[model samples]
Target: MPEPITQTEYWNGDVGARWAAMQAELDQVFAPLTAALLDGAGLRPGERVLDIGCGCGETALLAAARTGPGGTVTAVDVSRPMLERARARPAGGSPIAWIEADAQTHPFAPEHDVALSRFGVMFFEESRTAFANVRRALRPGGRLVVLCWRALAENAWVHVPRDAVLTVLPEPAPSPPGGPGPFRFADGEALVDLLGQAGFTGAAVAPIDHPVAIGADAEAAARFAATVGPIAGLLREIEDPALRERALAAMRQAMPAERPVRLGAACWLATAVHPG
Candidate 1:
């Protein structure tokens, strides 16, 4: 068998292109969670900010707006396609520097006032080392806020459609324990402990629950579900065309018989401070 791809290659390859193509839709789908992350960040005017895994530039653009013209935004991601898409988009407020590099090991200037990530920060190969690098990028007393999925079971926005798809296809192999994935930080306590161990102070995690509308209708919602996130990743691995269609049908049928398919998304709003 061929060697498994690294996170950098995984994101910069086809997955990155797919995400870039769906950037606008994904932004809309994740708007609420983005708001929660930005709120937790508490970005101030003229405060420099760093955005990790700044996919398609949503959070970074928003952070730039919050920080205004006097501030600067450094948006970093490993995916070149996503970074290109982000760079192409129009931005307002602070100037943005889009850097295509691994945030896990980037040598960021230690002068940022805040660092933030939305649905990011969970894919690092070494969580402790990655967070330690992030901590090193902050100025004294700088804040770090991140949003990560709490658990697969608690996220109806994913599992609901995922269950439907699974009805037609077999479940994919589980990721290795403590491996990088969306739910890598499901255990809030462990995450906080890891943050502390990474040399951050005042580490804490709080639950943030919100309902997300994937689409205006069931069909649309199912399409959106089957095109992004974990379900999308699962579907991509299947080579059988017939099996793929069946799985897509199941996703559509699993949607609630309602106009707007809104589902619960449970995440952890984790925060830490750079002790300088």
Candidate 2:
């Protein structure tokens, strides 16, 4: 993975706190989608599941309920501030074990039955290596499932705001034609291929057009974006003061009054069985 440009600032600074709070808001916007991201996890009554980059613990908490009393769920993330919110969450079931480690290189046990990531695998500088680490963390018969964006054009939530932010900032690191944006795993085929290279088979991707319900006002939404999510930081690079204001202003106006705006976001709901 590309070395984090600002590891310390990104991980433990105000940006982190802003993001945690921002995620809290955005997750609420994505609550419904969260349920579907976990649609087929098959979190049986007594099985274990690992939620990688388990943002805000939404899916992790859901998996915990599925596991019931005999089962366990371990949720891991790279951010302490984010995990703090997860850890401090009111008791829903068994307290989820929260681990603060890079999902790419954490020393993970290989006994878990399933490994899952929801909109969390895209930040890696090196996708192959990250998945390789995740593969090593799973048992021989385990499965890996992930949900990522489809393409930039498919979703206004991403591209629209991205267009707004980038206009305000300096050009970012070059991204792929259709991907490597914040939502790198947008291509299901690409994910399947990568998983195969990482030594897993039966990788499959399913499309999910989740209508996101954003905040009631544009300013609220922009605050959420500029502070916590990826767009704001990207916009910070814009040296042209007028362009920056216009871009951010555009994002605010982009907010939809109707909840669940039918913005197309491809959720590559993929699962690959570990080769025994």
* TM values, all candidates: 0.97, 0.84
* Model 2 TM-score relative to the real fold: 0.84
> Per-residue lDDT of 87-174 in model 1, one digit per residue for the tens?
9999999999999888888899899999899987998999999999999999999999999999999999999999998888888899
lDDT of each: 0.92, 0.72
* Full-model lDDT, candidate 2: 0.72
Score residue 109 of candidate 2 by CA lDDT: 86
On the 0 to 100 scale, the lDDT of residue 201 in model 2 is 82
- Candidate 1: C-alpha RMSD after superposition: 1.0
> With candidate 1 superimposed using the best TM-score fit, by how many Å does residue 62's alpha carbon deviate from the native?
0.8
lDDT of 2 by residue, 234-258 (tens): 7666778887678778777666665
